[model samples]
Target: MAAYGRGAGVAGREDLPVLLVAVLLAAAACSIAQAQQQPVYTSIYDVISNRSDLSTMKRLVDGLGLANQLTSGTFTAFLPDNNAWAQAFTAAGVTEAQMLTTYRDPATTLVNFHLVSRFTTIVNGSIYNNALKISDLAVNSTRSYDTEAGRADSDYGLALTRAGNDTDGAGGVQVMGRSGPPALIAANQSDIAAGLSYCNVISAVARFWFDTYFDIITKSSVTASSASFAGLVAAGGQQQWLKDTTLTGTLFAPDNAAIAKVQADLKLNFSTALSQQDAADLVRYHMTDVPFNRSAPVNPVATKLKDATLTWNGGQFLSVAGTLGRPSNNVRWVGFPRSASVVPLLDAALLPLPSTAWKLVVAKSAAAGASASSGFSSFIKAMEAQMVVRYQMDDTSKVVTVYAPTDAAFARLESYTGKPFASLASAIKDQIVSMHVTQGAAYTPSGLLTATPLDTMAGSRTLNVTRASNSAAGVQLSGGQTPRGAAAIVASDNVMYGRSIVHTLDQVLIPAGVVLPQGGGGAAGVASAPSGWALLLLVALAVCVQRWALAAA
Candidate 1:
């Protein structure tokens, strides 16, 4: 009986251990289920109100009368914390009191820029909700989204840039306003409540778009790199145009370095009073009546200057082809406002006219003789023989495009005609040179490729411009006589001389009614054109002659 009692006691102890293990396992399962469940809330307003860091956002929403919209909409809110609001106010050099009083409309617009909605549409009798999640954004790329802000349909309300592979990590996402620095997303601050999503940002987005062009240009904090440009505007007495909110346009502002270089080159003194007419003309040349942004198409945009136009080529890097062929350096699209979009840090300023085409041709001939590539010795000789051609090449007032023949081109002509270019009659030489010069418009290579039949200086004669198969020399020009064929532009945008541009050609252009010396064999030996300092001296003499002739006239 005693042995049976001890065995029963041991069995009871064993059962005690098993019972404790079972209880522990059940509690672990319950905890896991609770962790996986999503939190529930009433609306986006409730979510913001519950967060201690988002007091500023809540106040702005309530003050702006936007609480009702946030209470029921399927929307996403990029809320700036109280700290962010404070920093933004400091940067803008304004207080919250001023925002509520003096800048109420802009403050309202600022709040609206933060809210984006999910679009609900019926497709094929089925409901679809196009709501964006942080996961939906591509890594390391900028994406545009529509916000509640009232802006043009073509304009982007918000530009979101995602940086890292981890979407949920800290500092992985940022939002850019029309200008200034981008606002960063705080870590683990994203939440969804009642179909509304919200993310807290560390800084407030800029409110530049609401300001006028003058306001932005003059703001030191906003445009520190563009101080020179702002000074030019002030000196030019064109502040009224930029300050006026009713006027809208685009300003291609050159940076301080570019402005300084141009000022020195042109012997300009912005510190002193300038002629209003000259200043106005210079200012107008840098602006366009229409506003253009980063998303603007690659097309010719008309500037305020009637004849001058700029071509903006859209890509990873934005570039503008102005009076000076597309600048060797890149042109950046800095930012935009409601009144104006400012593209800045241009390597060179856009001038109304470059240096004289004749001077450039003469310099090229001097630097490199007829035997070397890009030599224009023969073309120079032809121009020197014609006083009228010299006048056109040297004139700064008249814009023109010159399709200059290379020494090789003249050699080709000589080979075809069986007569040296120097032996040609003065009448024939004048006609040949005139046909190469297109007056009234200084077309860049890009302009020439797309231009219609262009009338040359040679009375009533037109040249047909077309695209060439050779990618290096992208353009071809055909004269009135078809049998003479086409002259390929060997080198395009070779020089930007005063109000004119030069393109090197492989063959001489022959206009109709001008008879060529008929022969098949090679020409006799001709006198070599001037070279070195001698050619340069000739160029100086030509300039003096041009000035004297103009002064006499």
Candidate 2:
């Protein structure tokens, strides 16, 4: 019986080709049947009508009278599902009847933000090959399609970024609308089974749609024009510059009132002719490399203005600085666009830095640290001897966060090491000083509350960030080669040099060594807190650290 079974298996193997052909034929017939039954959408109306989830969107399309036009056009429609509509209704604080009647045009415009007139079907088969494709909304020519929201026509209008075989070498691919972060097609609602597939293009319902983009120039001109920044157009020739669609940037526009006050403080007349240097300084101080959404608070971002850079964290709530005359002093967000935002500052323009962070530090070190009143002489001498300050100041890419110790901190280090700081080898001095710096990342006092395991410029070493018992201590950041104690970030965000953020530490951070100073491994050094001017000396040391990183870069 076993021999007969083996022979039968062999015969089946020999007839495998015929069996495969039969299976293929069956599959072909099934595909033909499925194709015959496939629902054809003559218009977007048919597509929306087929899905119960898209009922709200269908009402919008019908209300706009775009059913006939959409049916014959090739386009990609990002229809919001029923859940999205419910959320939108709740957010807008309106009932469905009121939305259709009182808010019809506004509702139509909101719906139009989702529609892109193009054949933007995601080729599912090609996605496995890791292709990255982006669609820059091409058909946005007139108010009929995309109504101009802010000052100019949309520059970053509804971009569709598709990644087939994600370039990051990650296994899965994603499709993103330039509204926010990209959503995974396979992971999200790739539920096209219920969709009205057409020959021209297919529409898949999106989890969410992108926000409407507004140009910075347009937002500034309309919202900040009256009281906020009337002279921004006149003083800096910003009217012509911003209107040019080719350039994109973040403009921190001071209100005309604020500008006038600043001018009075400087004793300069706005109406009179000014030097090219002064006008450039006034304009550049308000400019940042990246565009920020004034409507929302932002994470701590670096500004291009270097010395008088606009640096603030999401927690700072800068919008709260100029809005009303109440206790909160909030700044008003006068514009709605994401690409270009207009924020009103009631007080003054950001002043330009006299020199780079490195130069400022070098001066401070010489003036304060080397002086009899300041105790940072030993630390300054060692740094100057090594020329570490030069290296740190030269690098532009790195934003060195220095936890500089006062002269007293160095005195304690000298007492522990059984040698003067200046006597140590150049290599040892470099390692010791480098241990005090956390490279690349910049954290404000508020940002430090959550950041931890901060990597130092010293390779492989790390530090922990924690809040002080008294909020006045700002934040304590500490770590080393060994388990020596924490240093209090006494004065935080007090210094900005080029891109370097300087924080003054109450005690010097010593990496692991045999000579641990008394109370160095513990929080016993808090008594030697730096005065306000002493804190400036600590910032000077950061310039030295920046120079080192720059040389390496």
lDDT of each: 0.67, 0.49
Q: How well does candidate 1 score on lDDT at residue 265?
A: 40
lDDT per residue, candidate 2, 410-496, as tens digits?
765666555667776666677677776666665666766677877766667677777677434567766642223666765543333
Q: What is the lDDT of residue 517 in candidate 1?
A: 65
TM-score for each prediction? 0.43, 0.32
* Candidate 1 similarity to native, TM-score: 0.43
What tens-digit string does per-residue lDDT give for candidate 1 at 1-553?
8889999989989899788988999999888787676455677788678778888888878877788888877676777889888887886667887777776766887787777656677999999876567666788988767787743232335777888775544557777766567777677655454455554444666443634567556642336767877777777788988766566676767667766655454333444424455466667777775765546554566778777666665432221323331222222222221345555645556655445777566655654543535788888888888889678878866677888888888778887777888898877778888899988877877787677688888888889988888635677887754223678887654333234677888878878777776565433332233457998999999999999999999
- RMSD of every candidate to native, in Å, equals 15.7, 25.8
